[model samples]
Target: MSLYQFGKNLVLVLFKPIYRMEVHGRENFPKSGSVLLCSNHIDNLDPPIVGACTPRMVHFMAKEELFTIPVLGKILLKVGAFPVKRGLSDREALRKGLKVLKDGEVLGLFPEGTRSKDGQLGKGLAGAGFFALRSDALIVPCAVVGPYKPFKKVRIYFGKPLDASEYRERKVTADEMTIVIMEQIRELLEKHR
Candidate 1:
């Protein structure tokens, strides 16, 4: 197995027992083609947790600051994560994300832009919509509800893919698409709640 897969499996083994993770709707995941795993961010553990649950290898867009750390940076690089600046529009990060989709890989990112401290759904950033439109990727809305503490029975629900074909040819603005994306994530969160 590749280093990324190996690491993911290792994490799953350790995390499943601790969190009592229960995954739902994994059948909605597309077996192949470009896909955007748009999820609601609740905790720092969300990325790895999502990665471990999905069968496909997920390339995540981590905060740029995480890439500046010494040993952690190298580990993140090896684990299929790229750096993304949090606040402003980072063209470089977007370009990398687009490249992943264009190459027919799964790209996972939080639509909320940052982790929600209160575990409430937040407005999604335009980045998810922009990438979906640009790459014509199918967006799989995922909801992760958890306190993220040991033995808490954290739940991950993967909703149906939001096909971008309808918006691909249209002149849809990023902000408009962001609203749609956010709505889908909200629906998924509600379903699981």
Candidate 2:
């Protein structure tokens, strides 16, 4: 396991006793090779909280500013978390993310792009769809129901891996495509919520 996975697991182990974590459909997650985990955004804690439910290490794209902190940046880097620029195409972040996938790892992304202020899902950024199409990776739909108080149970449900059939060889505008992909993610989330 990577050091980040070790650290993440360690934290979960400590918290498991106090906070009830219920995970369903974990079998739906791909067992190997480049996979993209797409989920709705709810709380700031959603990333690590959802991370704790999965058996494998999942990387997420965090804002670039977070990496400005010296110690935290080093920790996040080792664990698979990479920096992404908001409101712009971050080619460097995309390159690094693709590299992680090439290394046979999972990349966790919030399709909604940013946290939802009212706890409702938002439209996804096109980058996610582009990544899936370009990399030919499996997209695992995930839903995390939360805003859990301390020691409260955080419920997470994993949906079946989405086949990128519709995205294959499609020649549509980026904006048009992102909406369709985001809707796919939203539909999955609605099933459990």
Which candidate leads in lDDT?
1
lDDT of 2 by residue, 1-193 (tens): 7686677788678766566777888999888978888888888777887787776789889988889999989888877798999999899988988887788888898877889998778878888877777676777878876656677866788887876756666766556655666776677667766
Runs of candidate 2 exceeding 4 Å displacement: none
lDDT of 1 by residue, 1-193 (tens): 8889888889889999999999999999999999999999999899989998997999999999998999999999998899998999899999999999999999999988889989999988999889888886899989998989989899999989998878776879888887888888899888778
Scored by Cα lDDT, where does model 2 land? 0.79
In model 2, which range of ten residues has the least summed lDDT?
171-180
C-alpha positional error of residue 33 in candidate 2 after TM-score superposition, expressed in Å: 1.6
- Model 1 residue runs over 4 Å out of place are none
How many steric clashes between backbone atoms does each model show? 0, 0
The local lDDT score (0 to 100) that residue 43 gets in candidate 1 is 91
- Give per-residue lDDT, candidate 2, residue 149: 66
